[model samples]
Structure formats: structure tokens, C-alpha cells
Target: MKVLIVDDELNIREGLKKMITAFCPYVSEIGDTYGVQSGLEAIKKEQPDLVLLDVELEDGTGMDLLSSLDVIDFQLVFITAHNKYAIDAFKFSAIEFLLKPIDTDNLMHALDKAKKQIGNENLAEQLQILKQSLNAIRANDKKIVLKDINSIYFVKVSDIVRCESDGQYTQFHLSDSQKILISKSLKEYEKLLEPYGFIRPHHSHLINRHKIVRFDKTNGGTLLMETNCRIPVSHRKRAHILQVLDNQQ
Candidate 1:
């Protein structure tokens, strides 16, 4: 794995290089840059497999750096300092991120994730989705990018009726009788969609509050979605589901 460290801080760049070289044996070549301009140049020349990128640079933010690139061929792991909103955007987009004062464990974990996702054909599309998600976060939009093996679907958050877990896959049931099964965990979508009024009524199901046609609490609770799907509600989440629906009404 060829890696690049891009940050304005000299100490941070050096510290990350030292830790990565010591702990991450998969990394073959290591490159360093101190700011956005140099980082862009280094990326053009080195074409590193993964980049440990700081959120803020001397010249511009990481988002600026991303915007300058026409096509992102390498994987990115964002380095930020306790920005919850930005982190949520990353999570919603399924992008990797590392918190500042980076722990060895977290860094290694992010590296491992990057290694798996890097070199895949879907990366460019996924990065586009990442960019869109960031833009959506800034604009307070309720759209989500859902991808399958050969296609990417940009769907409104409100149009989703429910998400059902199929092991590592989550099947998205849409309002228009369309179902998209994505290669992501239901828990991941649950966390990502929580702010958009999606609730996990069962361990296997995350339902949209706006899509529920009726709530049947008898016989351990079930929600009848607008899609005509009856999703079971767990005992633990039954009251919470009802409360969410009530609040919406």
C-alpha cells in the first residue's frame, strides 16, 4: 500500500508517518505534504493507494482539495478533530474517517478498511456519493445515495418505506414498489437515517416514520408500512415506535 500524509502540521505528518511505518506493514511507499497545493501535486506524481488527509490545511479545507480533483482514484481517510456534524456526513456516506489525536488502533482500523475498499470499481461512484452527502449535509437535504453492484440510486430519504437486514446486506423498500439491496449493514443505515426520522422497530428492520399506514400493537407489535409490508416491531422498541409516530402526527 502506497500512502500519503497530508496535513498543515509538520508534527502531525511526521507522527503519522512514524506510526504508519511501524504498525502498517502493508504500506510500501510513504509520501508527505504540508498543505493542499503540495498535497495535490504529490497525489498527481505519487498516485498513492491511500491518503491520510487532514480536515483543515494552510490554504483550504479538505473539501476544497476534493473539489479541485476531477477524479479521485485513491482511497481517503479523513482526519478531523471532534466535528460531530462532519463525522455524521462521513458515516452517512460510508466514508472512512479518523479522529484527531489519532489512536494507533483507530488509524490501523481505518487503514484496513481503506485497503479493502480501495481498487474497487465502485470507488469513484462512492466518492461522488460522498461529495453529494457532504453537500446535502450543508444544505440540510434529505436524499441518500444507495448503490448496488452495477448501479447507483439517488433516493429521497422520505421515499424509503423500510430497510430490512439480510445479514450484511440491507434491502431498501421504496414508496414506489422498488426495492434496492445494498451491501451495507442495517445497523449502519439505522445510524445514518436516524436523524431523518427512521427508527429501528426491530433488530432486522428500520422503518420510516412517515411511511407507516398503521401500528398494530397486539401480538407483540407490528407496523404496516405504506408499501403494504407488515414489519414486526420488537418489544423493546414498540413504545418508542408508537411515540415516534405520535410525534409525527
Candidate 2:
């Protein structure tokens, strides 16, 4: 597959090109361009299968370059600095990103994921969600992109009833009774959802506080969800959960 590296920094472009050549055996050709306008021209001319794009450029931001495009058929892996807001935006959209200075293991993992998602039809939708998430001022206005093995779901944060841990996977229970199992760990989602009022009442469960129908004290402590599902509260978390509920009242 053909790959293009788009970044303003000469060292970054050169370093990434060298790494891709040394590590990515599937990549047949590698090209690069500096700044947004040049990046646009290179993409149109070369039609690369994958683009390792920097979040900022000399001429314009990476989002500007993407906005100028009429079609996006290539897989994208964003390169950004350690900015919390930008990382959260990427997470909300379920898009692949690498933090600078780049790590070899992370690059390879992102490339592997991109390879598996080469022909996915949800790229446009994911990009849209990314844009919205970046501009969102409130967590309620933000949407999460959940990609399962067979389908991608754009779900509102408010619509999530609960998230249950399944080994390395997290199963999302939606307000509409739809369950979507994602390949990420519950710990990952717990951090992302915590700011939006999601609580980890047990090691195996992340529950939306708004989705609680009732709290049952019997059988130690249990949460009765709006979906009528009973989720156990761990002994260690029982006091904290009760405190949170009391504070809410």
C-alpha cells in the first residue's frame, strides 16, 4: 500500500518515512509533503492508501486540509502533541492517533488497526463525530463512535445505559436496548466516561448515573438500571456509590 506523511517539521517527516520503510513491510511506496496546500496536492496526485498526518501544518491545520477534500478514501492516523482535549476528541470519535514524540509500538499498533479498517464505510461518519467532539462545549452534546467487528455505531453519551467489562472487551448497553461489544477494555471507557457522570461501581461495570432507576440495599448493594438490569456494587465501592447517590439527591 502507498503511504504519505504530511507534516510541517522536516525531522518528523523524515523520521516517520524512515520508520515506515523499516517497519511497515506492506507499504510499497512512501511519499511526503510539508504544509497543508502541498499535502493536498500530493494526496491528489499520489492517491496514497494511508496518510500519516500531523494535526498542525505551516499553512493550515490538518482539519482544514481534510475539509478541503472532496473524497477521503485513505486510512488516516493523526500525529499530535500531548494535548488532553485533542486526545479526548480522538477518543470520542474512535479515530487512531499517535502522540509525539512517536513510539514504535504505538505506530505499529495504529497501522495494524488502520489496515483492518481500510475499507470501512464509517470513516466519514467518524470524521464528522470527531469534528463535533472537538467543538463540543458540553459532554452531553458529544457523541461516541463505537466500532464493533461487523458495524460502527454513533451513539449519544446520554443514551448509554451502562458499560460492562468482558475480559478485554467492554459491552455497551444503550437506552434502546441495543448492546454493542467493543474491543477496548472497560478501564479505558471508564476514564473517558467519568467526566460525563459514569461511575465504576464494580470492577466489571461502568454505570451511567442518570440510568439508575433504583438502588437496592439487599444482596449487599446493587444498582437497578433503567433497562431493568441489576449490577452489583463492589464492597469497596459501596460506600462511595452511596455517597454519590446521596450527594445527587
TM-score of each: 0.54, 0.55
Mark the 10 consecutive residues where model 1 has the least summed lDDT.
132-141
Best by lDDT: 2
lDDT of 1 by residue, 17-120 (tens): 99999999999999999788988999999999998888889999887887799888898898888457778867866778888888999999999999998876
Cα deviation in Å at residue 82, candidate 1? 4.4
Residue-level lDDT tens digits of model 2 in 82-194: 46877998998899999999998898899888988887889998897787556443456679999998999899988899999999999999999999999999999998988
lDDT of each: 0.83, 0.89
Off by over 4 Å in 1: 139-249
Model 2 quality (TM-score): 0.55
Candidate 1: clashing residue pairs, number: 0
The candidate maximizing TM-score is: 2
